[model samples]
Target: MAFSNDVKIKALVACARCCCICHKFCGIKIECHHIIQEADGGSNSFENCIPLCFDCHADMLSYDDKHPKGTKYRPDELKFHRDGWTSKINAARPADYCDEHRKLDQGLFLRILRRLPWNGSIGFISTNNFAGFSFDCRALLDLHELAACNDDPSWEFIDPTLEIARANLAHHVSRFLGLIGMNTFPTDNPDRNSVPEEWERERPEHFFQVVDEIHEAASRCVDSYKTLLREGRRRLAIESPADEEPTSKPKT
Candidate 1:
């Protein structure tokens, strides 16, 4: 039996819409594949599905020895890839996606919450707060990458917030790089910005404000992602099998 649309969509999202074997982002349509072929009695469930772009899907299905480039993937190997990708994504994904994925997402969120700067004993510092700011910048960048790599329209909700956060972060990074007398930043980066005339070291207060804006934008973006995820999950659940129990976290 063919997997339900819910399972197929969930599998695509869980894998971040990239081919597991080739690890390439597909701009075109991806096909949902069965690790165990349906003809072999494989159940049409999330755990049994994998997402592959057309080329990779064709390669996987081709078992001809003459086609050396076409590597045949074992069912267990595909499952491992799915499980590993799911774990990585769960760290950054929201709980509204799927119940099977939510357990890991919740655990990762708790871990992130525990690491946040909430220590009451220490007062907040202003200048040269590179570590904390850099962490947030990297996180936003990761989310942006996820959206780009998946090419999924569902992630459009957070695009504007990401743009604002990236702009703010880029300005900060450029200012820092300029302080060290570097003339150029990465040219290919969409977020790269030139150091502005007003971004001098004496204007530390203004710099802090930019950082605050970045943090605020990031928080808003995170909330928006959670909202979209909840909506997506709700829609998926409406199409899901009623008796289906969400898969538990796979053994690590």
Candidate 2:
């Protein structure tokens, strides 16, 4: 059964119209997801609802318990995330939105910037040839974690524009990761790289097509991140360093 209107409204308000998982300000692009599947006898109560963005909702449903790959977000974990976010939103005071509180945190912004991949991970994926390539999965893992950091309350920008830009960057990065599949290269060894078996045997044309798609997604991620950085710097009144911008794809 679908969530009732009351339940949906409550969830939306509690999450402040942002996604509970990524904490991105989704505006009207948010959805009420069932923490437990309806097929599993999950109810349509407010307690069973989770507010998520389109990408996060898809990710939550994509996990297959029967053939589990990566770590699945359990129902309890979803509840924890939802409850914690709601508490924060509810505890926020009106004065928190005053001009004094809207000042940008330069140190916080710098820390977040340091966590981003810059021209490293996304740059490599967008510019490299993926054929017969066993990508170092650790890089992707790091990127995912960096993107997920957007959900941390400490990362929230007081400026609405900056926060929106940050959310856009996180959304794009998460979308790119979703397209690639987080555990696409599940490995027993942490140091092992993940090579798509099909890439080795598929027709050259087909392989190139897949590579092109990945390149496009990775490029979008880079663009979103660049936008965030630009907005962040402007909000913080910080000048960009000489080498702050991503350079052209490195010559092989």
Candidate 3:
């Protein structure tokens, strides 16, 4: 079966584009091997696929002198190695490696900034205005982005500041959606009016307060991201040399 780009990306992300057996990165190319061969009744699903370098793939399908040539490797053995390496790669992911997630976070922050009032009062803004915040923002800063982040190790950095900011925004958006008879959350009381009874009691003052708090929290996350980028760049500069030195000095 021909592999789709989505399936290939999923496999690469799961194994970090490395060979499952020898556990070495394949650089640009890695072959997608079926954990259970399709010829042996294996479907072309995600669970049935594994990423391997050409050499490792050959080794998996071959038997050395220690074993008879006719004997082939078992699927479970390959699966075990793949699972172990996937876990190690995910665990070793750098804290500041979330470029895509960071972009989504920034996108949502920009949208929120646009909606906020110049006077810092959200009471004037209706709940209907921010409903789109729940939509997936390129696999970050959205309700569904969590699944993407979970699947991709590179996007797994959990910035506490970003979490707090997102939670603040989600709370406000969820409350607004809840008040409008939308059932996105179990806590949503759809029986209430559009404005909700509790919020009605708090009125504009509570609305303003929530807006101010969320804005401040999200702004802090932005600053934290900038600091993280600076630290990461500085570390890279120190760890990597600008040019490679000669292995031996001149013979003169």
Q: Report lDDT per candidate.
A: 0.45, 0.70, 0.47
Candidate 2 residue 43 Cα shift, in angstroms, is: 7.9
Task: Give the clash count for model 1.
Answer: 0
Model 1 agreement with the true structure over 174-242: per-residue lDDT tens digits:
333333223222223535332232443666665555554543433333334333334434433322112
lDDT for each residue of candidate 2 in 1-252, tens digit (9 for 90 to 100) = 699999999899887898877767788999999988899889999999999988789888788979998889999999998997676577553345655554545666676666665655755655554445566666666577776775687777656556556776777777778766742464466665444656547665665666566666677777877777777677666654423455454222
**Per-model TM-score versus the true fold:** 0.35, 0.57, 0.36
RMSD of 3: 20.2
Rank the models by TM-score, top first. 2, 3, 1
Model 3 Cα lDDT, one tens digit per residue, 36-117: 8788898777777789877668876676648567656688977786786676567554365477655554544444333332
Off by over 4 Å in 2: 4-17, 25-30, 34-49, 54-94, 97-104, 117-119, 122-164, 174-201, 242-244, 247-252
Q: For residue 88, what is the lDDT in candidate 2?
A: 59
lDDT of 1: 0.45
Consecutive 10-residue window with the lowest summed lDDT within model 2: 243-252
- lDDT for model 2, on a 0 to 1 scale? 0.70
